[model samples]
Target: MYACIAQWIPPLERPRFIAVVLYAIGLGTAVALPMCGMVIDAAGWPAAFYVTGICSLLWCVLWFSIIYSTPAQHPRISREELQYIENAVRSSGTSHNGPTRVPWKSMATSLPFWAITVTEMCNSYGITIIRAQLPTFMKNIFGLSIKMVIT
Candidate 1:
């Protein structure tokens, strides 16, 4: 999605748009997790899953309804804007005929790929562990209630 934004947007504005999108995602995560945790505390873990599943479904609906694959395919894009995207793409010498084939075997076997993947896995695991265990830690260590821990 961010890649789509970066591609359709003007070059000077691309980074800003991508950054805003990333920040929005980060902000949504920050807000949603604690609320989900609270829901778990009140209604048990299954409620959290239900909430997440419903939200995911809604996002799917919105994505399919609103998003187009490219500026050329978008129904509502201005002619000038589409021309601009076409010109930029032409200048970049990158085809919009669909992405070039990726070197999957080479990429999968690459040292840098493995290093980055492992690092990301560890980081995600650490964050998951903290999210799962922190409320208990707060309750036990500081005698905090669920509300206090979540808020």
Candidate 2:
């Protein structure tokens, strides 16, 4: 997504837009993580997932409605801007060609790919463990109230 935005948004505007995206991601997760714990405490785990699921679906709809595949195809894009983008891509050899098929086995065998995948998986597990266990840990370890745990 950052790459996609960087491709079209002007260089001067790119940082601001990237900052906005990062802020949205950070804010959304920050809000949702605590809210999920609160919902779980008040309602139950099932209700928490139900609410999160609904929010996720709504986000998907908004994403599809707002994002365009290419600048030229964007409803708000001007012709001159589109021409400039095409020319820029052509000049930089960044233009796309028709898709090519790749074998998954080749990718699977790549050492760097596997290393990155393992690191990403570990990082994801760390995040998941922190989010899933923090509230319970606080309550049990520190005798915190549900409100404090959630917050």
The candidate maximizing TM-score is 1
| Model 2: number of backbone collisions | 0
Stretches of candidate 2 exceeding 4 Å from the true structure: 2-24, 41-44, 84-91, 103-109
Against the reference, the lDDT scores of all candidates come to 0.80, 0.79
Candidate 2 achieves a global lDDT of: 0.79
Q: Residue-wise lDDT of candidate 2 within 1-151, one digit each (tens)?
A: 8557645765556678888987897688789878987998899889989999999999899989978867876898789998877676556654566566877998899999999999999988997898778777887999987777676
Worst 10 contiguous positions by lDDT, candidate 1: 90-99
Candidate 2's displacement at residue 41, Å, is: 4.8
lDDT of 1: 0.80
TM-score of each: 0.72, 0.70
